[model samples]
Target: MVGSENEARITAAEFRGGAGTAAWRVTATGPQAVFRAVSLTQAASLVGPAVEAAERLGILADIDVRPEGVIVCVPDRDFGGISAAAIAFSASVSTAAASLGLEPDPARIQSVGIYVAQHSATDARPFFAAALGYEDLGDGDAVDPLRRGPQLAFNPITGDVPRRGRTHFDVSVPADQAEARVAAALAAGGRLADDSHAPAWWSLASPDNHGVDIAAWSDDVGD
Candidate 1:
């Protein structure tokens, strides 16, 4: 069980350092755990325990149970990021899963978002939010209220040479897995666009020149 020390907001690194969080990974959305199961019914069985765990912490758990597994996320919507309460909830869920003979596969934890390059984010934010039925995060980003769709981030166009692609993907994964994922993408015909931000993020382009950033910074301290 979490105590008063676990009530404050913490960085991804701090969250990961705590006990009972080994099964969870800090994603762009928050701390998430992916638990594999043999059947949909088995996956569904975790929902009640997970939800109850979150409720005990006075937070809500976003759980998606599919045919093969269950994805659980504890996001602090009020704090606009991961809070200690969220972490506590995550740990509780993991504990419950363990008791039920389930364990999280951290490598399967990731979040996908859309990156939109714009000259003036203020001018473009409203349009994208309205078009996608997303909520503007007031931080040059927007997200689906139901968390069913990828987040949308508007980045400023820098320098004289404009970016080749106006829109791209931002795949946030565990820091340790960033290099391997990049290599796999390259092996699958993707070309490196930029790696100056390696370890934090890497830009790659598809065969057709579309961009995708494999980002691991989201789980870092300063992200």
Candidate 2:
């Protein structure tokens, strides 16, 4: 992680987690500071001067800046392909961000993540990937599906969603990378999500079970 002497100390701090520890609250002092996790030896190259700036400004006071272990998210909506869903989310997030005044350039960001699933027989690879010569695998594939897509190029007018069967994989990707992935999905004619991804929520489709949990919608409906 890149930082000034003062910020470097912050970036190097140890983090605690249930599964693993990460470098916590890493700081840098510069105009376009970026704080991301890296091996102890690769700190300087991966961490950049921009992150140092954010640190000098005290942005790390609230969140964990440099963290270990991959954070993953899966879409509540199913796409015909895992890559398509990731791309859809990524593009939509960027459009939303630009409308909000945070104009972050997509190229400088590092490390995007998405989801994979345990596949059984009868599950087909997403059409886009299969067309590109990616083979399917049992249990799962060796590579992540969404990482291969166009970046940051989406069309609001032509956006769509490809229908998915009951069984599939749900993956989470970093917001910026998700934008690039979404561009690809849009190019391939896939649908985007109406709701954002969050940990406390998940969707399960089961014909046998149904419940009316009115409290979930109360906050949005003026209750």
Per residue, candidate 1 scores C-alpha lDDT tens digits across 41-149 of 8899898988787778876678999978999987545434566677677777888888777767888888999988876423467888999999987567888999899
lDDT for model 1, please.
0.80
| Ten contiguous residues with the weakest lDDT in model 2 | 211-220
Q: TM-score of every model?
A: 0.88, 0.22
Q: What stretches of model 2 exceed 4 Å from their correct place?
A: 1-44, 47-121, 126-129, 135-138, 142-201, 204-223
* Residue range 1-223, candidate 2, lDDT tens digits: 2222332221111111111211111111101112333443222332233234234433321111223311122211111111212222233323333343333332332321123222233323455245554433333342323433321111122223333233222322222244454455445544443224322122322233321100011111110
CA lDDT, candidate 1, residue 100: 74
lDDT of 2: 0.26
lDDT of 1 at 12: 84
TM-score of 1: 0.88
RMSD of 2: 17.4
